[model samples]
Target: MKLTYGITDKLFVWFFIIVLIFFGTILVFYIDLQHIVKISANIVNKNNEISAASKKMIENLLSMEENEKKYRLLGKDDYLNYFDTARKDFEGQLKKIVQMEARGMAISDNWKNLYESYLNISPRLRDLKKAQPSKIPWIPVNVINEWIEKIYIARAENEYEVYLATTELNRRGQTSARNGLIGIGVSSMVGLLGIIFLAYTTLRPLRELLKGIRSISQDRFSEPIRIRSKDEFGELAGAFNEMSVRLKEEEQMRSDFVSMLSHEIRTPLTSIGESVNMIAEEVMGPVNDRQRKFLEIASSEIGRIGNLLNHLMQVSRLASSAIKIRPLSIGTSAFVSECIHGMAPAAEAKRIKIEAEIPPGIPNMMADPEHLKQVFINLLGNAVKFSPTKSKVKVLIEEDEAGTDLMFSISDKGPGIQEEEQSLIFNKYYQARRIRGHMDGVGLGLYISKHIVEAHGGTLWVESKIGQGSTFGFSLPTAGK
Candidate 1:
């Protein structure tokens, strides 16, 4: 069978398990305490019973002795026999009292000491009856009376002691029960609060994550994920934010690629259509050698579109592995000089002067050489296109305490980019709206150069102002020793 459960459900299940274990242990402690309380009550009751039996035995002995004296004074045989029978009965009761006193001894030490004193003095009173002295000193009777009095006093004392002990034990038991109940009550409240907090805290993030996932499923990459948590949920939110940024970039790239494709294809189609119209109207009269030049130019424009498409496809492949740096030590000055030399022909054609400044002690960089070269070439090419006739394009290289870097400043005397468009300049298909002159190629050159520079652990940014000039610069990291 297949089973499914949500994350919150699982958390609740574990929470219940923990609570169950905690309460179960408390319940066991409560049961054990109850048993102790019951044992204490039984001990107090047994001691009270021993005290009552001792009182009864003392009363019987006193009644039997009075009967013996009355029968002797009257000289009645039947009364004497009754006294003898009562004496025997009293002796059996005394033994019973002694056994009961022994039982009281087990309950508490005070009861045991009192019981032993009573047992020792009671035997002396029994000897007084056997002696039959002429003067009958009455001291024996007084002593017996004194022993009985003491036994009664001890019994009363024992009863009082047991009563006090029972009161305290009961009080202690009640206090223990109250405290345990209070503990359970407090623990229950705290557990309830903890469960509520756990549920609400976890559910909030889960709801946000669910909403974000649903929005992403609908291709809404622009929506921001709103999750604020300090735990793993915060990490998940960060991951989602990164994913949204990547998707947004991909959508922008797809849109730009489609727009560029239409523009490239239509430019060639328009020229081809114009050429066909001229040939059909006999405007060139059977297409002479000079007339064929127009056809050649139109065909070449179509071929140029094909070449641009091919180069763009290659560039797209290279951009797939964007920001994957392959670091290697490369001479800074030599690399910059080579880039300038390679693009010198184009610079010369535009009548743009090139200035190279490569200091003797400039260090190398750990970077992708080919990507760095592409970045310099793109910057130089832009300078060549925008610079006025006889204007200079400067390439400077220098090293500092921070790092060794080469700055290629391509300043143009032409009307520069607007302040607002500077940020969007690196964006694909985001051409400067204020750029007046017609420029060839889509705005992918600077964008591609920006990605390449960043991949080599560098930064690309333009310092430009309208109608003044634009100087684009990039920096790279120096190779570590």
Candidate 2:
């Protein structure tokens, strides 16, 4: 069994993937930031505590030195007591510094040895001072000064360590920021690619469906839409294909019926036309003026029916691709003149002037003479039929700009076709809305003429605007000189 993945399913999957990538990047960054913060905080806090303890030790050593100086000058027991007290306070601060060094502070070995020697000498120095009342040794005082200098050095080193820790923290912060920007950029690129993929998948099938609909509208029922997906559009395409097949079958049935009907009616109409023509010509007996007039009307009506039947037969033959053309080379000027002369009677009834612009030295075209004449007659007849009285109908023939084809155009001063309907005018049985009730044709003239032109490797087109008159034109390849 094949899995049917719809557009909704695809959208959900892509959304989930994008969300996962975004959050995964954020989580990794959070872990890295926490690690950096922990390490930096430990280093900075330890260095700050060591710095504070070293400052207190320096003050205690200075007091010890001051009290010893008083004992040597005045020789008092109270001064000795003050010296002992300051010594003990200094010992307490030294112990604290040792403890911090064991944890992580980087105190120098020289500083530690100096601290131990000062502790060992301080008690003996006090006793000797009591024993000898007037004399005091200068050696223990010098040792105390050296210890004070060591404390200052340790404090400066601790402050420097603090600065180094702060700098490391800032560097880590910048690195995290850069990594975050890279992560965001990657996520956005992935999201944009996902959006483009989704749009292409969705719109491709819709475009194919639209194209198929347009083809069907133009009477093409054989082209099927091919969408290779297990989605709603696929189902719709299957149904559309079925509908096209049914429409093609129905169209064939209709064409066959029209062809059969036209054939059955044409034989009787031909016989009746002959009988009416004979009566109008008075071949059977002499007739009065009134009788002759009625006979003439009957003859004309019969002839019109015959022409209508002939048109129906021609349309059927064209549809079946059974109309074969015999190509011949004809003089361009003379042939166009003959068509114009044939249409002159109809134009005269409306007092419309028919003008021709056949430039000298126009080349002859390769086309079926009979079928080509029919095309010209159909075009000219439409012009004469639609033009108002005293209006001018113009015919122009010339070589196209490429110098390889002949272009013929018929222009009429009639109510023109609308722009929207111009493309649809050549379709079978498609009558212009404005001329539907007023026009006499069943809209087959242009349709048949278009096919006839196309059979000879040519194209027919119209240019028109509402109330501005219409020009119908066609191009035919010329016979090479």
Candidate 3:
């Protein structure tokens, strides 16, 4: 049965070819090395034997020349016997060289020819002892040494020939090995490219699938993913498209449910609050201390519920992109004063001082007055809530670094946020863990404020350390800048 692999397994298998190529190259080099070593040994042994025989021939010739001189000086037949023995040795060495020459070994032809000519003069040299010294044809040592010189010259030439041959052989070996390595490298490179191409055909579908998955995680349900193959990846793509359609439907249902519920709850909450107010004011009847306290608790809970409902409605509107901003030119100092005035009662209740460092004659900003005030109220409220009773909350208004936007920062001497939790604090329904004490919120305040600031083409961020107080700041573009 044929087996098919997943993209991962195919990748693993394809990459394994690289490792195999490396080992294959090593094996090829080793085979080449063995061939070279064998050839080198055979050539070296053959050349060494030829060189030794050539040297022995020259030595025997020199011995014969020496014995001839001794017979001339001492007038002894023993020298002639010694000279004959040396001649026999020279012939034996020459015979060996002739056999080697027949077998195509590199022996010098000049040395062999000279030895043959010297043999022709041998009958004359034997008759030298029989004649008187004057009749010996005045045999000079130069004549005898002349043949020895020829042998030496021939031996030197043969040694040079062997060196040149061995050097040529070594050069050829290196060239062969280099060419082989280059061939392997080129083939390996081509193979690697082929593997990459094969892997790409499989990985393309996976890349698209991963992108679609990321879009889904980001709540983008309308993004479509497609794969051409009828394999497993193509089927997964089909299933992914179906899931997107279902998720989009589910999101629509959720928005509809929230809108309907918010409207239904608001009317009863207003009526209940009015009724509680009348009871507390003795319009209906005089109330006892315990009854008044219960009324206060009921009133507080009703207000909390109203705030939560408002937050939910705003979130729905924001999600649906229904909120509109009617930006108007508003004075900076005036904006800050209005925000402070609105939150003055709450700050006073905690006895927390509100400090303002408004730069005089600050530039006006283009922003929705209500939304802008809401952003400040949310930030200032948090500051007031988190600050100690006697500590101060400072609001600083200045031109931003770019000089094109006015920056507003609310800093509090409250327990700061941790570094790791900084990024999560702006997320919807996310509240940081309080180190000093518990701070309460549904986590929607920062979320709403961030959107509001972003709607004005600005940004909101926080800077804090563990012990140092936190500064929450935002920048709004100046009017007409």
Candidate 4:
């Protein structure tokens, strides 16, 4: 029900489509070229033929004048006949020049005017010669010469016009060819880039999907799908990633439940076992000095059981979202120092020197003081428990921009946690098994601290080096209305 394509396939499709457009454009230009060339050639040929006819008309008109002069001087009929023949030839050519003007073939306005003037005078002069030959014997010859001069002027104008038309036609033809070539070039480049872009968009998701599959095979389900697209492939990747996360969460919850249950049952049963052993040994049988000691040890073990149960209950309540937080203004620096001091007895027993470095003018934070105190006390207590004898435990406070907030850092000079275990440190009941026998409490201090800090709109995390020491820090919001 879904369609997906790789980058190369997408690119190929785009390129193929572009090729179609390019070829279509080339065909269009080819047809345009053919039409332009045909029209241009026709215009040039027509102009050249008109020029030739105009030049022949001028020659014939001059010849007619020469013959008329000879006939007038000698009174010869043969010369008169020659003059008539040349005259008829000139008139026929002149008519053709007029027709060229009517057809819109590069004829000038001045040329048309001159031709009109010659046509009007020629007929009138011929009639005058026939009626008054004795008084104006050479009138026809004079009119012929005048007409020839006018015809020459008109022909010259027409020739110049034709030359201009020819030049312009060539210029326009060249421009059209150049534009067509440029269009072809630009379209081809655009299509190529479009293909490349389409291809990259298609292929990147497939690569990401493959990499995700490999990571899943290695039992790593934390990497979420990062591909952002509107296609079916993107939707599939997102769905698969969501499923992976849900499964991982379910599996982790199952493991945590089993481990916590075992620990809960074992702790109480151990306390009851120890108490029953003390009674069976007859240590408290007579209810004397040894009896008192046995009762004391049993009481202490019972208290330990109660503490363990309380911690388990706290984790369950926090995980199930049963706790509600009420925020109030409290001095951050003072509170942090007090929590550190409260753990002084434990540090003193380990011979660890505890110190607080609270700066002046620290901001007050908005949070539940009791919850924040529990967070700080748990961190400080862990520092005291793990620090080597005579080693120093330091607490530092500072603030910065982005909002008024408090940063409390507790550092301990003890064997630091391994890098591989750092990420799981805040997970519920995730104790470092290697150091479990050396400590007296379950590994819920940091987990509970993380929950409380987050509930107060803060963050908690740890930084450590294997050989040097470990630092636990948290951020709390500044005081506000």
Best by lDDT: 2
Worst 10 residues of 3 by lDDT: 136-145
Instruction: Identify the candidate with maximal TM-score.
Output: 2
Which of 2 and 3 is the better model by TM-score?
Answer: 2
Report lDDT (CA) for all predictions.
Answer: 0.67, 0.82, 0.79, 0.73
| lDDT of candidate 2 over 211-270, digit per residue (tens) | 888776654455888887877878888988898888878878888888899889988888
What TM-score fits each model? 0.44, 0.80, 0.74, 0.52
Candidate 1, 281-332: lDDT as tens digits: 5787777777677767766676667656644654555445534567789987
Task: Name the regions of candidate 1 deviating beyond 4 angstroms.
Answer: 1-45, 73-141, 217-219, 222-239, 266-481
lDDT of 1 at 416: 86
lDDT of 3: 0.79
Collision pairs in model 4: none
Error of model 2, residue 302, in angstroms: 3.5
Question: What clash pairs does model 2 have?
Answer: none
Between prediction 1 and prediction 2, the one with superior lDDT is 2
Which parts of model 2 are misplaced by more than 4 Å?
48-175, 282-295
Which candidate order results from sorting by TM-score in descending order? 2, 3, 4, 1
RMSD in order of candidates: 13.0, 4.9, 6.3, 10.2
TM-score comparison, 2 vs 4, better candidate: 2
lDDT of candidate 1 at residue 182, scale 0 to 100: 71
Q: Candidate 2: lDDT of 179? A: 74
